[model samples]
Target: MPRFRLLPDEQLARSPLSQLWREFARQHSAVAGLILFTAFFALAILAPLITPHGPYWQNDALLLLPPSWSELGLVQYPLGTDDLGRDLFSRILVGARYTFGIAVITVIGALLMGLLLGTLAGMSRGVKSSVFNHILDLALTIPSLLLAIIIVAILGPGLLNTTWAIMLALLPQFVHGIRNAIAEQLSQDYVIAYRLDGANNWQIFSRIVIPNIWEKLTLMATMALSTAILDIAALGFLGLGAQAPSAEWGAIIADSLDLIYIAPAGVAIPGLLIFLAVLSVNLVGDGLRTAAKKRREN
Candidate 1:
């Protein structure tokens, strides 16, 4: 008998992955969002090289100057200085690192924790599943922002604590979603066939279930990213997260509000960045949904 390779031929070629990318790229809005998002991060990474001065470097002489192009503004102060005279453009570039980085980390932690617990809950039934489901439902019933606030209040405010708080706030949704998807997959004929072929539960889960659910997980993660970023921003704005002198979008916005009438762009610039970032993330989620439309139809 011709023997099968231990690894399937499909593993040697990325046809499915390539097809998925082709579909994702076909979405013009998503593609545009991705391009802008990529540019944002690229600027973040190149901040040191591109920024004219350190983000924290202040010039008391230039306090509250408008955009350089504005007749009142100086050429050296392009977008102008905040009330404290910190460079607005440089600050925003650096803030991108903190604002986007923390959100991604918190969401990743939630995803991993959810995967471990959800897999166990979904693979088994009866009392254990019941217990997990009830707990998840209870957690989900609470609004996530409120849950985040509670966690932050309990832990005291700091960068690490804020990340953990966001992760905890987002955990239930991931767990519930993964659990439902896995339970649904477990009932399919393919799983039964795998059992008949003498594949153990672990093998079936790793080889079949995970591959099938990857798309949904990716979709959810994209959406969750926007939520995480927004929550982090809210916490910072409320003075419970990134504190003064830290280049975080929310902190910048919070601090700039007092100067809104003096330099409306000071408040507008950072706020617009946050809005654009979240919008682009949602666009990516839309792309994922479009890619999966056919699968849903089937």
Candidate 2:
């Protein structure tokens, strides 16, 4: 009775969450992507505090200055000055607030709306379901960006309008994907058993359908986020999103385009930030997909 025995490794069972975390962590690229995105988010949040100069501040004397490493660079402006003599580094940090922040908010809205509408549509019978499916299919046929642009055109383009337009454009994808996933999960024997056991539609959706399709949901979310970022930037570049005086990444690039020949880094830095944001999100999504697959196999 006084003797205590150590548990065997096999007996020391890990929780499902811990197991999933371990699986996700095994993918080095995913970890790197997570870290990268976190850094970007932090920079966005702390931009006002950490930036050496105001994003809108202009220095007539420092026009088109190169980065600190460049021959003509100044120590004060690490990433150098834009064509307007605004601090390029500060603009970048401030731009991240609009670019990354808007995409995140849009995706969350789309996901929530999708989950509600898709679940109802999936659970509907006969003609109602068919009508929902048809509408979703019709919406899906239009390219998301085109749909977003059309909505923005109708709503009158601005940052808030662009966010709404993108959310609406993304809604159909989430709805259709989730609807199909729920339908597939409903056909499974366990779901049938739940139905036979008298589980209501809400109960079944909450307990069975959602859990089964979480992986798909996560993948769609990441993909949607990346798309939102690009679309926001594109709209901003076209002057239909963030307007003049905004330091949004796309607007930054558009503003700096004229200076590309004279100060290439001005354009390149913002462009590179967009590229990295998209790439990191995609990498993390891919890693999660692989981890989910492996978890299922085991």
Best of the candidates, TM-score:
2
Best by lDDT: 2
Candidate 2 lDDT by residue in tens digits, 85-192: 999998888999899988999999999999999898888889989988998999999998899999999999899999999999999999999988998999999999
Error of 2 at 10 (Å): 4.9
Q: Which runs in model 2 stand beyond 4 Å of their true positions?
A: 1-12
C-alpha lDDT of all candidate models, in order = 0.86, 0.90
The TM-score that candidate 2 achieves is 0.94
Tell me the deviation in Å of residue 294 in model 2.
Answer: 0.1
RMSD value for candidate 1:
5.0
- Candidate 2, position 285, lDDT: 90
Q: lDDT value for candidate 2? A: 0.90
Q: Which lDDT value does model 2 have at 247?
A: 92
- How far does residue 245 in candidate 2 sit from its true spot (Å)? 0.7
